[model samples]
Target chain A: MALDYALLVLAAPASGHSSLTAVRFARALLARGHSLQRVFFLDNGTLTGLAAAVTPQDEHSPLQQWAQLAEEHQTELILCISSALKRGLLDSTEATRHERPGATVHPAFELGGLGLLVEAAQTADRLVTFG
Target chain B: MTAAARKSILVVSRHAHPGSSLPRSALDTALAAAAFDQPVALLFQGEGVLQLLSEQDSRAAGVRNLRKVLDSLPLYEIETLHVDAAAAAAFGLDRDALPAGAEWLDAAGIRALLARHDHVLGF
Candidate 1:
């Protein structure tokens, strides 16, 4: 069966294995013909969308990897609005609204409300949260 | 959505406060689901039972007090609060030290609770 899965990312890119594991799981599931409904980032997981994150030359950039995955899979990448704001992961509109210096959110991701996660939980065949 | 139409969501909080913020997020998720008209249940298991201890002050620590959030669960219509009996006992918490209205569950009861839910989000 081609199950539709929604992933909740709760771990930061550099903190633990959850983010990388989620990326790998997404790739694997998509390859198996499963549909990824959305990838919702919460808590420190919102840090994965940092626009200015610099990766070591020897290491793969999780930010770019996530961006590429969303682009290729047409997957919705959402960051929790409160969590993003707390971590300063803002989009252009949010930055302007808050009169911040600049937007730090990447183009691939959008800031969203908790309602989106609630909806995803209701609609997706499976909701997997990685933290 | 009506009661029958909504998905039954179980938010499993398994961590202690002050050490990690995930416990707060788990409660937030439950409240959000309840606000969205989904059937929501919150379970405090493992080290998560530590959150049930009354009067934890985090004002000086500069972090949001999770008890404030937990106290608000009923206002959101999330009355299905659960606590693992073993976890609570392991933490040496008397029943009075915990909040009122929480149903204490044994291991099998917890298993049944998970089985009945449409979705389980663990933290």
Candidate 2:
């Protein structure tokens, strides 16, 4: 039977290794013919979708890769807005609220709440998390 | 009802035996979810490999053997069990040393397996 998958990427780029691990897992999951319904970013994982950072030439940027994946796969990338805000990640609305210079939200991502997490759990055939 | 329609949870905990409150919390959550007839799968990762070691004595920690609790998982019908391959290797644990029926998975495999469950709770 076909399965709809919800993946939680919970590790930050600054964290040891979870971000890369999550990307590899997400790629492999799609390759194996599973359906990815949503990709919810929480805690440090939200950093994977930040749009303002400039990546050094030698480093692999998770944000760019995830953005491309979202566009190609049409996966809903949800950034936990509360967690992002607390961590200093601001969307256009938030950037306006705080009068920040640049918007942190990426085009491929949407600011959301815990309701997205609950919805992913309640709706997906499977919920997988990488942290 | 479809499995997707029912409430189910998969817990991935990678702490040692008699380790900390985290593993216990994961177990408690799994047990509670199972009690509600929600299918639960407990996947052990990292140091959580120690959890499957037989003859655990939690009395030193003023606790009961967690293995004992895990053994009763079948009674709750929470039978999907998984252990991380790298964790077992890190601890120098042989495959045969784990609980008889638990599936051993590599990192990538574990990732895919997790994607096959309804909900994932980790500690």
Top lDDT hit: 1
When summed lDDT is taken over every stretch of 10 residues in candidate 1 chain B, the lowest stretch is B1-10
Assess the local accuracy of residue A102 in candidate 1 as a C-alpha lDDT between 0 and 100: 97
Listed models, DockQ each: 0.75, 0.15
| Candidate 2 structure quality by residue, lDDT tens digits, A1-131 | 76888887767875676776777777888888988878988756777767776777787777887887788889899987766886678878889988888787778888887666656676777777777
Candidate 2 chain A worst ten-residue window by lDDT: A113-122
Interface RMSD of each: 1.3, 5.3
Real contacts recovered, all predictions: 0.74, 0.24
lDDT of 1 by residue, B1-123 (tens): 455556788999999997897887888788888878788898999999999888799888888888777777788887656999999999898887676668899999999999998888888
lDDT of each candidate versus the true structure: 0.88, 0.76
What's candidate 1's DockQ score?
Answer: 0.75
lDDT of 2 at B32: 57
